[model samples]
Target: MRGLGRVLDRREEIEEIIESEHKRVLPKLAEYREKLKGKTAYITAGAAHGHAIIALLKELGIEVQGAAIFHHDPVYDNGDINSDVLSSTVKNYGDVKHYNVCNKQAYELVNILNRLKPDILIARHGGMVIWGAKLGIPTFLMEDEQFGFGYQGILNYAEKVLETFDNIEFTLNLAKHSTMPYTDLILGSSWESSLAKEIKADLLILSVPITYRLVLTCGYVGYNGGLRVAEDIYDRVLDTYR
Candidate 1:
């Protein structure tokens, strides 16, 4: 049957894709393991940027000792992440430092972090970030994902807040580009399919009273795109205490 043949083809394609990504991640994993061999790393999960950072760090074989996962949650039923998904996809080591609030395990994670006194804290999600601030430790807040329309209002607020925080990071969007000649200025990031945001595309930011702007970002894709910026700030956060 045509449907059957199509299904088989799709399956093979998926396998090929997985194989490619695995190859890409493997060497990077080795590199990370070498650098972060013994350091304690804490990470969060709530969105793609956070997810990628945590996953990549763990994939690189970092010594992720303690974690506080704010799983923005594709994992609904199982208190634990599902087996089908990549363990690194959600957080370092599948949120190995995951704390279940029902069991008051979240408290345990905080207590453990307090005693262990980790060198770096990489956090995502709003509430956990607030908590990280209180810790007075080196912390990196993962900026959230924003679709084109969603970015306007957010950017308006962020323009003010970004003034205060040293690092306001977001995952590069994985969306197709829009080609309309006009755009708005009140927003931020947008979404697409396939891989991620490419510099070639122009984004329109919209506002209420005809104040529109186009965001033309160059050299955008993968962790390297946004991550390079984060790493700089991460270094600064570390230096502040050290």
Candidate 2:
């Protein structure tokens, strides 16, 4: 009985923490939602994070223009058919247009972006950001897989997004000078292999796998993470003059 009592107490403590955090974060999120509402975004990530990001974006009143999952899992470990990532995402966030690509096929992604022309692109991997840059889309590179969980997580996300939007000019300038090396046919005989230029893209690295910049202990796990993402995106879009 004592052990059971302890377990119950711990559970209650956790609940209290959660409730406290919720109260603290919701008002800020509401503020962000007002600022971010109606904005369109295209998301590209792996299975689980893709769904999470979609949900997070919806919470901020952002419209998902489209989403592409790197892979799809037909079955989850829980053995619940309805709980699969794709089904759950649709169920929770409405019927968002989504694609399930097994690999990072740049051409396919580019085609989708061309058709959608979303206001922004959010991708999990660094490589994917280049395509968005080439197409003059503000891109957010989400590196920290674990950063979107709690109250702090969401807030961080919102801040980061706002920052990204605030710096749109840099991205545009980079895009103007950058080129997408697509196919041999596209390159043709005029393409010189020896000719290279120092060109960069306006890519906001949100977390780990930092290439140019260094980031430590950043993530997109909870409420704070969601907010951080929102901020970065807001900033990026605003900067883009979009």
Candidate 3:
């Protein structure tokens, strides 16, 4: 587990990067805040990052009508839910609905939204974003790279690359019938490597479960590419807290 000082240090790095690269995102966030005035909002956040956004909304005077906070399952080992990390930030906001990320379901989300009847839905996950859109509710996604392309994503990509290589080797071996005597050994090695890679990939995914804390606030500070505009905004707005 990382210490709070480390977390705050990471937050500082994110703040610096936002200060340098994504200067416009903060202004855009402010603009959105202004636009959201008088509109009631329903927010669902995974990990501490979600609470930060809620804090920001409250600071900007937006009416946060309801909030759903999802913590990753304890067995997943992403990290223990440290309520203390966000408690101070969200104190006056009132009781926040809590759920486990593993238990999240589209139907349950919709049912909650239907009950809340907020003017807009703000969430950190893409599925929730899509759900909001489908229900004719305005949705805003607060995200960083960890949402899709973080540790788990890297493992997924590596697995695909290895699989592709194994497929190419298997095809080559099949094409050379004249060398059938040697094919058994080559094919066996290829198959074994492929199996090993698949197993390793699966294990990585299981151990490094795609939990909310994997890419919480300030996680985007060091990345240099992809979703430039959105990443810029996410990192910048998030950096203000530091």
lDDT of each: 0.44, 0.72, 0.50
TM-score for candidate 2, residues paired by index: 0.67
Report the number of the highest-TM-score candidate: 2
- Candidate 1 residue lDDT tens string, 174-226: 11222222212212334321111233322322222323324356333587856
Q: Higher-lDDT candidate among 1 and 3?
A: 3
Model 3: per-residue Cα lDDT over 61-130, one tens digit each: 5567666668734324445554554656656655444323433566567676666766667787766766
Q: How do all models score by TM-score?
A: 0.38, 0.67, 0.40
What's the best-to-worst order under TM-score?
2, 3, 1
- Which ten contiguous residues of candidate 1 have the minimum total lDDT? 171-180
* Clash number for candidate 3: 0
Which stretches of model 2 miss by more than 4 angstroms? 1-9, 76-83, 181-242
TM-score of 3: 0.40
Q: Which has the greatest lDDT? A: 2
What is the RMSD, in Å, between candidate 1 and the native fold over all Cα?
23.5
lDDT of 3 at 73: 40
